[model samples]
Target: MTTREIVQKLWNLCNVLRDDGITYHQYVTELTYILFLKMMKERKQEAAIPEKYCWDRLRALHGEEMYRHYRELLTHLGTEAEDELIRQIYHNASTNIGEPKNLEKIIRSIDDLDWYSAREEGLGNLYEGLLEKNASEKKSGAGQYFTPRPLINVMVKLIDPQPGERCNDPAAGTFGFMIAADQYLREKTDDYFEVPKLKPFQINQAFTGCELVQETHRLALMNARLHGIEGKIYLGDTLSSLGTQMGGMDVILTNPPFGTKRGGERPTRNDLTFVTTNKQLNFLQHIYRALKKDGKARAAVVLPDNVLFQEGDGRRVREDLMDKCNLHTILRLPTGIFYAQGVKTNVLFFNRGTNDTGNTEEVWFYDLRTNMPSFGKRNALTEEHFGDFIRAYTAEDRTQVKDPRWSRFTREEIRAKGDTLDLGLIADESLSAYENLPDPIESAEEAIGKLERAAGLLSEVVEELKAAEGGNRK
Candidate 1:
């Protein structure tokens, strides 16, 4: 099925529970559980289920009998799963939006889907649309699971993942990077290309991920499986697993969660070098330790600008990163790019290389913030906005790059500045002056200039509005 068709079908069913105060996210989650159960039932009839579950016997009953047994099965399944995440899935599904009429509508809508066809075409698109709608809700805070698809595609293209290379996203929300990488490799290699030949190890062959949210993790698994890619995807905190070595990786693409420090139960890890509440720094340190020297490991980290210049342990971590690895590129992201409102973020790309005791050669910086044409809560971050970054990334050429969108800085230039501040782009004199503009000289001169400009702009706006009003009246 096409993306629109799938969206329309699911949306029609969404109305039944809209009155239950079920958010778009909750509706999608409930639907996901029911869909999984239905598919498992079908899979069992075709082949033996890998484990004993209600789905294995869900097909036995029909009509009211089927509904009764299904509800009972869900309750039983909720108790059987040991993982809190799994338990939550069944528990949430069994209670919320499971009113008889709503439950019947959900089951019937899910039943309408031909599992075989959905397995082939609709699954990935369906989940993607669900993610988009959920992010737009702006309440569930599930938007963190979604990175801009265009941004993800550009990063995957720049990294240019090869078949059989072990790719990972430690903060794999909805598995966007994994999906993009798999699609990239599939397109580049021919149909006859043997995946096994690309790598001898089959079981550990493809992509892997770690997601903290259980629902997101479940969606990530479904996302990967829909694409026919297979491997272990754990539902756990990536920061906890950071210092513990996983050998190394070829490419790591992630957009870790962003926000001010909030209290939560912290996970224990023995390998962490720095103990601070700053999660971004902790994740960066983790990625540093996880990369293999000379393995051509490159990562695109999404973080707020505070990590670039924050003092104390945050600044210390940056110093350590600069000394240990090659800090390559920084893409200054804009305000509305994320579902999380007013968030200022950037993408830091670096290759994990040998500890050669030399400063980073040239750090490429792309100022995409201003160049972007359209941005807002709903209509934000399209692929077009990222086109320049993709081209300048030079993924296909790999070496001998040229014509970058923004300028590159040297180690000396960075060192001259305090804390290697990744200040936003500077091009025009007016804008650059504002960024580097000194504070008012303990006088009102600078303040007067600011007020004058504000007055001038307001006057211009008033005149324009008057003219438009005059025309409308005529």
Candidate 2:
């Protein structure tokens, strides 16, 4: 079958697997395992996987025996696989298929599809299609890790990643940013067929990432490998020592996880002078530090509204970001574009300064969120939503331009406002005097989300004050 048809068939089987009470996340995790094994077998790398528990063996079984083997196979690989790729993919893996028929059905379905090289775009795209499907389901909580492709494409176009340049994503969930960058260069250079072919090393080492969750990490590894990228994507908490481990990236495109840090623990790194349990704050510190000081390194990151306007640590991080980098642009993303609904997000595009501070002169803001459509599956967000933004982005000398949706803020103005990067023109009509109003339920949910964030930040402040008071007593 064609790659699309194969992907469709495999995805259609998710309905059957759902009957086994498997969650979408669990279904994708299990499918990743089987898919990896099958690809290896197709490439004649059977020795990499043990003989008894190989895909061939799984394919030739049925009923209780097959189900037992599937479960045992996951354990064996996790415990005994010599290859780290094989081990990591199966680490903590378990078969969520409660029914043997479901297991057999998925295995047979995958087996029937044509297994192409991991480098082939067809197979890689098919896998990505499945990932996107899983993300859209939303119930599995897989959506947060998956940024909309339209956004990713726009960011990649603006950043304009090139071959032979190092790209990384610190909080890479399924490595969507890197995947898009890889594809961009491929299409730009016609897979290196139009231009002189990229050196083999550039083809392999050009992109790297770090994913915290094991299942997502495995999927990212497979995704990159399938796209012909053979680079390391570490599986661990990125805010710890891992944050300090790498630096000097050419371009970084990532949507860091959205949430307050858990358990009120400080990051494990000594590199960041300012520390807090706010995960996004630490990530912001790390991302700028990861850039080179020569002004060549640039990044585009997706962050929440609190990161822009929260007090204390938020102010400190924003100040540091402005001082150390040119915080050039902010694209205020619309609500509901993400599978995680009601999230108000913005993309910060900046580059490292040649020195320690004062690189930023003016910052442009594009308001795409306010008075916009509430995006959902039926009214899915598309590239056209970014047309004006992209045009404004590509315009020469935006400092001279004046538009409602597009505006510029001088660093002086921003510093006067306590270093908050949130700038915009459109008023929230939904919250104003207007005849037509939004769904009361939607407004309530947005309010609740804001309250929860404020609560989290307040708790952090309380803890900090408590620690300071205790230190004084000591």
Candidate number with greatest lDDT: 2
* lDDT at residue 67 of model 1 (Cα atoms): 66
Q: For model 2, where is the 10-residue window of minimal lDDT?
A: 431-440
Full-model lDDT, candidate 2 = 0.83
Query: lDDT values of the candidates?
Result: 0.67, 0.83
Tens digit of lDDT per residue, candidate 1, span 326-400? 887788876666764446789888877677355366677777866343355535567777776666666565244
Best by TM-score: 2
Candidate 2's displacement at residue 39, Å, is: 3.1
Error of model 2, residue 229, in angstroms:
1.3
Per-prediction backbone clash count: 0, 1
Task: For residues 1-474, write the lDDT of model 2, one tens digit per residue.
Answer: 465666677778888876778877888888898888787776566888888988888888888998888889999998899988778778888877788888888888778665653325466787898899888764566887899999999999999987878999998899889989988988888786765656564567778889888888989988887777777789997788886666888899999987777788888898896898888888999999999898979999999999999899989999899899999999999888785567789999999988988889989899998878778776789999899899888889786556678988899998898888878747765644452344455466556756766897999999999999999999
